[model samples]
Target: MARIERVDWLMVDLAPKVPRSDAIQSFVSQETPIVRIIDSDGAVGTGYSYTIGTGGPSVMALIERTLAPLLLGREAEDLEALWRDVLFVTHATTVGAITAIAMAAIDTALWDLRCRRAGLPLHRLAGGAQASLPLYTTEGGWLHLEQAALVDDALAARAAGFAGAKIKVGRPLRQDVVRIGAVRAAVGDAFEIFTDANQAFHVDEAIRRARAYQELDIGWLEEPLPADDIDGHARLAAMTTIPVAVGESIYSPAHFREYLQRRACSVVQVDVGRIGGITPWLKVAHMAECFNVAVCPHFLMELHIALCAAVPNARWIEYIPQLDAITTQGMRIEAGRAYPSEAPGLGIAWDWAAIDRLAIGAGQVTLGSSGGKR
Candidate 1:
């Protein structure tokens, strides 16, 4: 059995090549908290979670002070038990972003270790339901772009073999409708167009916009209402034929279960980082499947491709390139679909030199038998 030997973490600030804007927030930079765990057998696993900008230091502190100590000498393969132990110790802070984000980094690293030890890719080790999954592009659909650029981008994405593209809505109702119409006209009737409000609208506004978007043969309406507004989402979903997609803002499986039971959403947009990691991520996906709901997970496409391929109900993987500069390789997209890598574990080859150069000074932590400091 491999015994945990040490844990180290760093916060890296990643700026988008171009600024990404949605309804509620303009993403200036990503605050990524990365964790590495080493076991007695000399195996290493790395995992990470992200925030829009703030909270990286807080997440790192929790990992270094509370979570990492709990993992000190445990068996590396007991992912579930270790996950529970972390949660139980941090139970006071459970059901919130800090707790979940910290748990995600640890849980994901464990899964990565497990897959490497088993000598299999994560998809096959998880279930291997399909080899490749369809792709959709959101990179070209930022809310700040002009109509001309939006249309041009949609056309380009279609030519690139992507099956669908998501456009950001929540501008004035009329403007949102016109933009969707412009994209639809450019990509034509055969292409699928989805819209996301990023939780920018209230129930009535969301319903009004969803009604207008229906004429465009839109694929799904994502996060139109605040994530906690389950009643509003159910009301809106009942009023419109367009499927409601959520999960990026959700923190736990219990929230997804409530949304499913109440019929608040049609598409499950589980984010591995947001949902605590691959362990709970799989649970949420299977739970969605039991309710006959389709899963179309949010970002981190490089890591998500494996999870999507492992589950049968998984529908689409959002294309957002966040790790391009720090990684030697990333997800490969071809003819509108993404395929998981055959390489063992998460299949990402980190460019350690680049990561060290880009690492932020404020959020680094190292823990060993002497404990540590963040």
Candidate 2:
């Protein structure tokens, strides 16, 4: 068995193509914490996690100070065992954003290494349940866009072969209705229209808005209330025919279990980074499947494409190309479905030169009898 010989991490700040705003916050920049793990056989695998505008440095610090060291010299193939070790060691901070994000960077790298060693692409390695999945665009649906722009953007997404479009909610209910109505009018009832409030409503407000949204035949209403409010979600789900989607704000399988058990969320929007990588991500997906829930994962469609393709219950992939600027290869969309790459591992051909030019800081650790550094 090949042993993990070294672990390294870097922080890359990726600026958005345009400012993206939602109900709760605006994404000024994406602070991405990236990790590369090397095995004794000279194989390397890459993984990453991201934050909206801040806290990336904390993720990096956690990796450098704790997680990376814990991974030194371990058997690279023991992904689940290593994942548990890290979680146990960082138990005090477990079930939080930074901790999950940190674990994600390491766990994903391990999975990548496992896939590469086996010489299979991640979709195949994970399960290969599907070759492609339907796509929906969120890039054009930011809350800041004018109604006309939003309608035009939705039309453009449709013309580009997207099956659905997501428009932000949480405006004055009348305004939200008008915007959703305008998009519906533009695209007609054939194309799916989804809405995300980004956790900007109370239970009663969500009920009222969801009731209004049903008249428009909205495919789903996402994150109407805070993600932690299981009762609120359950109440809102019972109140409307619109499927309630959540998961990006959630950090663990246990949280997902609670949400699923309560019948709160109809669609699982599992973000791999927030769920601590593909290891627990699969657990969450299978859990959703068991509950008869469909998964429409949140952003990072670049890597998420393979994960989505691997699971049977994966319904749709939210198309937000945050890594487009720094990656040589990207997801391919055809007739509204995203096709997974055939390349081994996660299949991301990162532009390392571009990444290095933008990197803020980096650290490395090597393993040996005394945990050598090189």
Q: lDDT: which candidate is best? A: 2
| Residue pairs whose backbone atoms clash in candidate 2 | none
Question: Given candidate 2, what's the lDDT at residue 365?
Answer: 84
Candidate 2: residue 82 lDDT (0-100): 97
Work out candidate 2's RMSD over C-alphas: 1.4
Task: Encode model 2's per-residue lDDT on 38-58: one tens digit a residue.
Answer: 999999999998999889989
Clash statistics: count for each candidate: 0, 0
lDDT (CA) per prediction: 0.88, 0.91
Tell me each candidate's RMSD, in Å, in order: 1.5, 1.4
Pairs that clash in candidate 1: none
Superposition error at 63 for model 2 (Å): 0.2
TM-score of 1: 0.97
Poorly placed runs, candidate 1 (over 4 Å): 361-368
